[model samples]
Target: MLGRLFLKLEFKKVDYAELYLWLGSLMKNNCKQRRQFLVMAAGLLAASVVPAWAAGVSGEVKALEGVAWRNDQPLKLGDPIMLGDHLRTGADSKLVVRLGGDVYLLRANGSLQLENKGLVLGSLRLLSGALLAVFAKSNKQIITPTVTAGIRGTGLYVEASEQSTYFCLCYGEVELMPMHQRSQQFRFKANHHKAHTLDAKGGVEKSPLRNHNDDELAILEALAGRKPHALVG
Candidate 1:
């Protein structure tokens, strides 16, 4: 199972004590800090009321652990998540959400905006952090700080920051390009291969694989009711 695979891959931190200690560090200040965070998010949402309302029920939180927030509120297991919702996960948190036929796993200290325009997902922005995504047979695109990836029924891992974005096409097919240079696009078809870095200055450079494995892909794919097509490296 992918979950089991992730656990094994993370064996370097096999000491449960260390894992718990790391998670403990993510605890927010208190309810006061949470309230302040929510207030600020609400203020920003108010500035874009039309878009927020357009977000309808898209999925449910299949699994949630530790500190995670949805629409200015603490998330609970089985909580329904709507489109256009701004999601954030704190240190040592893990969230699994299924939207339409797409399954997304938001890791610790990550943030992203959810989206589903009518039926097709128009926009999903990973602001700062990383996520693992598995898509059912459909054309969907993911946006990070520097690039956009168009994928079809694929498993992908991504990390975004102001400097660059890391992309791993774990399996299936994906078309990638910089947000600044849409014309210069590339396609990748493989399982657990083809990793790259998209830089802020429109530089698409080959990057060595890091921080992911086939087991992670299997888990995300299972959540999407599919399986990764294991390929020879």
Candidate 2:
């Protein structure tokens, strides 16, 4: 009954460390059999709760490298990156942010402006530099100066500049369309990596994956409480 009750809890919102400490205090007052039951319940609770909690948390700074900024202020670990925030990274810096079931890694010299629907981010604009992202099944889009990508539960890497956008569908599917000619659109499905270059004149050219890799995708996905679908079995 105790294990069942714990399983029914919305544990994502609970502080697990404090919960464990409280359980420890209670166990000290119980007999051996009750203590054993509590230990068992704790194990079950942890296994069920962690993934849910990680997937449900939004606006969390999961990792930061070198120096980064959020809304023009110096960024720190564990900072809450709210929806509609303006984010930037310094030269040689990187930033990782978790938004509900998705994770994004912004590369050096990147500038991003987030767009939100209520409290959740539905889309984002990469003003300059590069970004790598993974998403859970949702209606999400990424916009750049030269192109826009509508993604559905996919892994993507993009670099944006004034003239062109380098886009790589790391895995899964994406609909890529040029900003200048929205009528020129194409869907790409990749099991590994499929690369393209979108020019300002609305030309799509096939390219090679240059800077990102599977290992980096795995790392970001793990932080979002999942594994790359290719690595899962």
Q: Which candidate has the top score in TM-score?
A: 2
TM-score of 1: 0.71
Going through the candidates in the order shown, the clash numbers are: 1, 0
Q: What count of clashes does model 2 give? A: 0
Cα TM-score per model: 0.71, 0.76
Q: Pick by lDDT: which candidate is best?
A: 2
Which residue pairs clash in candidate 2? none
Q: What is the C-alpha lDDT of each candidate?
A: 0.68, 0.76
Residue lDDT tens for model 2, 164-226:
999999889999889999888899999889999999999989999888766567655655657
Global Cα RMSD, each model: 13.5, 11.0
The window of 10 residues in a row where model 2 has the poorest summed lDDT is 14-23
